[model samples]
Target: MNILHHAVLVKSVNITSVAKLLLDNLLRHVREHVASIGSLSTMTVATLLDPRFKTLGFLSRNKVQEAVRRLKSECTALIASSEASLPHPSDAGESTNNSSELWCLLDETVDQKRQSFNATADAILEVEQYLVEVNLRRHQDPLEYWHKQKHVYPYLYHMSQRFLCSPASSVPCKSVFSKAGRSSANEETAYNHKQ
Candidate 1:
């Protein structure tokens, strides 16, 4: 397929939705890791508390106990919050099965992601503004300007790439080659050769 056609296909796929799907996958991975950590912590605690060897080092025992407590609390909290925030399994499954619907959903997701990106960009800009004002007031050298710019550079680049790939900017892949067929050079050459 041509570049334009490829772009059109990508645009049709609904990137925002794809990003959300990826985010969901990431969350699931994180949840599973948390659960595994919790289980490991519990096993560690059980092993430490076993009375088979009364000669265990005090520091090692204390460390294991502290780690178990912290891991249990943190993992429980993380799992609870993540589970609560996730979409219902049936809903997620349905979404996965419907490709066209997923495209619509993805558009919505992209919109939300864009809003989030904008907010982050604005906050970064505000910080830079604050720094500039402070430096100007204090008559300090603005040598740190580059440092401030660096913080927003990645976001700007991301936004640019996103905009370029968005449906509105995407053109059909066939258009790239189609233009050649419409060139006036061939017509001009034919007329001169006939003359």
Candidate 2:
């Protein structure tokens, strides 16, 4: 099938999968970078204490201390920013209620789907926090964190484009699927009537 036809058939697939992929990749990149930094720090500390490396002890000690300070600052900022950005569960109740009402007005059959979507959104928010926590422990630089996050922007943009073109429904996928199904059914009926 052509691209457009394939897109129609896959209407039920959530575009958020793209976002999730980006988020996961970003997290993994950050984690690996942080791990490398941690390993380097350990090696630096180890070298500084080695008797054979005493000639370089003073310089190595200073370098290690500087690295530790930088790491600490990065960790603090990451934790603080993540905590600030987290979606409070209390807010979910209000937003969920509003979304549920909107979905009910659009299609009563999709109330459960709307709820599930909200739940998934909440879960993603939580996952973001968890990633922050895991990465913060390693204490990488803020610039590096931003750099890692930048990789996901294109994916996020693609997901946003899909979302924008999508129909207005409380449950995003359900709404898109319903619209597609309706259109196909109407086309089939017209074809039969013409016959």
Candidate 1 lDDT, tens digit per residue, 1-195?
Answer: 122234444555556888768645544543443334323443333222222211121124444456435333433443344444655333343444578687768776775566555554454453334323322322332233333444544332322233223221112212322444454468788899999
Per-model CA lDDT versus the true structure: 0.39, 0.40
Error of 1 at 117 (Å): 1.2
Each prediction's RMSD to truth = 30.0, 27.3
Task: Point to the candidate with the largest lDDT.
Answer: 2
Reference-based TM-score of each model: 0.19, 0.19
Summing lDDT over every window of 10 consecutive residues in candidate 2, give the lowest-scoring window: 46-55
Worst 10 residues of 1 by lDDT: 49-58
For candidate 2, lDDT tens digit of each residue in 79-114?
A: 444444665333233345777777556653454355
Q: Model 2 segments beyond 4 Å from truth?
A: 1-128, 133-170
lDDT of 2: 0.40
